[model samples]
Target: MEDFKFTISKFLKRTALVLVFLLAVLFVFAPSFSLAQVNTGIEFGAYTGLAQTDVRIIIAKIIRVFFGVLGIIAVGFTLYGGYMYMTSEGNEKKLETAKAILKNMAIGLAIILSALAIVQFVLNTLLNEYQAGPTGETTPPIGGETVCADCGFLGSVIESHYPGRGAMGIPRNTKIVITFKYDILAGSLIQDSNNNGQFGDTLGGGNNDRPSAAFKIYPTTGGESAAMAPNQFDVFLSVDKRTFIFKPKVLLGSALQDTNYTVKLTDAVKLADGSSAFGAIGAYSWGFTVSTVADLTPPQIESIIPTPSLDKYARNIMVQINFNEPVDPLSASGFFELASGDPTKNFQNINLAIDEGTKPLISGNFKITNQYRTVEFKTADECGHNPCGQTIYCLPGDKQILATVKSASVDSSNKPQAQITANFYDGVVDMAGNSLNGGGELRINGQNKIVLEPGVKTLNQWQAASGKILDDFSWRFLTSAILDTTAPKLTVITPGSLAEKIDVAAPLNMAFDKPMAIGSFKEIVLKTNKDFNINYTYFGTSYDALGQKVILPTQKAVRTTAEIAHGDFWQKSPTAPADTESAIYYPFAPSLLNDIYQNCFYPAVLQNSPRCVVGDISESNKLNDNTPSCFDLQNTNYEGYCSMGEPCPLVPAPHNP
Candidate 1:
């Protein structure tokens, strides 16, 4: 009996030791298994349906599995101890050994339970800390089992918002604007009592109805609880109903300088058809930092297209005026006017023109673009072919054209026009409600020294004057019979063709032989043949004072590749085989790029031509074994590469067009 008891005790001790050793091995190699799963893109745990491989989540899962195994071992030992006690068969020594084993099993079970509870508590605390970062701002949860009060799954209802996500140096008094791909239901944004898709409803107190909770803005430091009250802001919809503007009753970030603020749109927002705005993913949110100072500096004219007193100006050219800052689109569209013939006779009240007996000579459409800073006027008449491309519009030949931008606070009857708010004037105000400083001064050749009226230096002074025109701006130019047919051509391309060892964050620089229309460059496309998952983010496009040279700065490249037995894993594997890592510029399409004279970059004759410019971006002192033809990656049958000349054939004879 003594021998039997000793052997059973020895066997149990050995089994326990083996189990502990196995558990330790699993704990030690758990990270390797997790990484392997991540590399293979495998999903596990109850969140198997979610496409998440966050390291913290993986670690938590591993810990859970380890504790689960421990619990199983504890249960197994309890069962084995019960069987040993039941089979003891009235032997004192065997019964004593079974009782000891049962006691040990109970202690082990208690320890495992306690450890699990402690671990679970720690993990929950850690996840909360990770979600609410150092700034106390709760990051939008991408994928998780944790439930949040104001949180919902990610969605793509919003097209764009200003101040953009993670944007810094935002003005405190700036109004927030959100543009959606589809028209929104007005009632979803504000309390529309009449439900006419307009803000005409009034409460019994005679106050404007408050906005709905669909739109929220709050300081991130204080979380959602500190959100601005609905009554503290007013909502206005655009004429198209695709844009909603939120104007706070007071300035934002007033209590602190350089404060971070978050904007959220809940699922309650709906489309014009009454469908959910954020479809599957219920909500959308972003954060931006506001500056301490407000935008109090009034807007000024930056440049004019048909320069003042210029001779032989193209008849087909569009008149463009650029402002120093983004101006209210409403103000620009209503206050700018154009006419033909003498300004003293044909132009009056800065709005009327009598070129053809009360009929305006230049009847055309006004387009406000470049983020509302550029206003363009295209005449009603279309001219024949010009050097740039087909002429879109034309002016009368041998005629003097006059353009005027008014800075009046009131209309011709001296009554205030429609106001954006109680104190915000409607006539030529900036985004922050600062009126345009157009007081009798005209910016000619990018200088403010050209003062038309000596005493009118401010909008207020201009408004006090008796003249119909108060601090208005006017420029005169003569149109000739000759058409500017010269199209702008590419002059220089930085990191010239096939250049190597380029910095990942380097700006793509391109210079034009002549000043190109700044708006036309928006069509240019820059892409790389790296992994499809890896992408580049262009910050913004900037140009020299001449608008001839453009610089496109991009964010630094992200690290996504890792070396494995079969070459680079994430970047050049079988799934993503373009290992050359080259950046290609697809030639601008016809009619997409235009010169100042409205001439298309690629003539209509060459609209079907294939042209691509390639720039190698391989690492220094390294060569890729697989350098396929550029056309193979782009999937286009293009001719040869050309930086500044005619397009040539790059592929074999049959592939050439």
Candidate 2:
């Protein structure tokens, strides 16, 4: 009990001394406050006391004072307990209570000191550093997919770098380039017109009239694995601020022989957000192979004109075999000759010359052969030039015989070039095996006819006879290619006008510009009234298969032209074929009436025919006049009805026709 009391007394003495020192310092250096300043209700002395020190120093002093006061109270209890213990007068219970009080006071002081030590260590190590701003060691933004951490953000921040090609790779031996397409919202990039460094008024928002987009590239292979070469690489690009397409070119200098090179994009070349190089846009990467210097050969003629295979009417022609590459004039001249065919024409007597004075131009003549006889021809060549040249150039020879030298034309370039027009006078065919048909005499007047050879058969008789030689080959050739074999367009309506008045028994159906396909009209309906606003349903077949009949299908209860007319009018009904059937067949103009609808007995079938009619033989009315007659069943014969009155019941239903 005595020891515990002694410890508390010592702590109290130390605290009291510290308090006395603080009070002395305050009294010596503190300033006086004006009465007005003290009007805040705090004592002037307290203000004066606080005024002597800075805020930090004053705060430390305040804490010291609080602890000092606590120490004083603790000391007072301890002394009282000691006094009680000293006066206990041999009573053990009183002595024990004094010891207990002294023990609790000592424990309280120990707890306070321990907490102070912990707080001091934490402030020095953590809080002090936090108060300082970020140093050079601060972490910088790194490459990764980025998204807004805060709420209310709908758009994304993506990098625009393009991958060379296949995911995460590019050819190490070849150069590659990439391009991009973007639809970036311009509103997201430049909202503030006044602020240079800032985006929109709100952070991360901006005007996006033209948003940010870019592309980048770097080495993918060989550059790092082997010794690097100087001046061996260069980046050639066509790029704008928004997009990039670059080709890496390497000068294959002596250091590196022939080898492929490649480049790739890296993390360092990307934007802060690690998005694509194309700025949230589409991109593509492509590569091309490069080759050393080399030469190219000319195209070869696989077969000759007047194709070898003969057409039925094919005749007289001169054809040649071609070479895979340009020929050596001297060697080609000697080697090129018309091979065998009809004995009438031979190369032995024809003039042969080197036709290559003009590099690419070449041709020869077979005029020395029997001019009246047809001949088949072919030619071949011995290779001359070296690089990419052929040792022997040959082509499947095509043939054409000269029936006559009609009008001819040729390319202006320097070469023995000529185009011949002639009939298949002798029915001669060239090498490749195509035949010709007859009735195609040459267009030229004098060359149209040719004398037939002794044994040659004429196309007209399939025998050796000659007349106007035909050029069916050219005609068929043109007809089969450029000229459309499709049916001629029927653009304008037939009969030309729809306003002309005609008999009511039959109506002139409209026509179109093009030939109607077979079987295209099963549901054609004819209408009444000039503009076709009011109508009749003519459920009948088309008379001309090539005529496309337009129909209005839904109306089943429509009235006929006869019913719509105010006066009596009638004409004979005729069976007509529909558009579908017309496609496969053509109709001749009717011989009974004029094509002029207004001057015919039957309006519909009245195209280009003589006008004739059969009605009351006893009546004094003309059938072609406005008083045309209608058939009446009661009469059992053509009689009695007239066009100037009400319509007669003699008109048959359209389906029946």
Taking the tens digit of each residue's C-alpha lDDT, what string does model 1 give over 1-657? 567446545745664565466456555754444233111222222112554344545666777897788678768767877888899999887788778768877776665676667556554433332111121223332232111222211112443456655678888888787656568887788776335444523222325555788878899989889999987866655545655667677888964668999998888998889998766657777788989987766676665666654346877776766677766654564222353443212222123222244445466655455555566666667777533224466777777676777653544452222244332343566667665665453323444233344433554554455554554666666788867765545555554444433333334555555545554444443422221211111112224444431211111111101000000111111222111122222222233455666665532122123344232222321112232223223324555544422232233222111
lDDT against the true structure, per candidate, is 0.51, 0.26
Query: Considering every candidate listed, which one attains the maximal lDDT?
Result: 1
Q: Model 1 residue 650 lDDT?
A: 38
| Candidate 2 lDDT, 1-657, residue by residue in tens | 567556766765665566456455544433221111111211122213443222333344455567677767877886887888799998897888787776766765665565445433332222111111211111221122111121000011221222211222222322222221232322222223434443212121222111122222223334534423322222221112222222223322123232333332222233324444332323322222223321111112221222212232111112322222222111111111244353223223112222234322112322111111122232233222111111222221232233221111221241112111121112222111012212232222244322212222233342222332332222110101111111111222222232222322224343322222111121122221111111111111112232332121111111111111111111111121111010000011111211111112222211232212332222343232233223222223222122221223232222100
Best by TM-score: 1
Candidate 1 yields a Cα-based lDDT of: 0.51
- List the candidate 1 regions with Cα displacement exceeding 4 Å: 1-161, 179-196, 199-213, 240-243, 265-284, 334-361, 382-391, 408-426, 441-468, 481-483, 493-505, 508-510, 520-591, 603-639, 642-657
| Model 2 weakest 10-residue run by lDDT | 577-586
488, model 1: CA deviation in Å?
3.2
Work out candidate 1's RMSD over C-alphas: 14.6
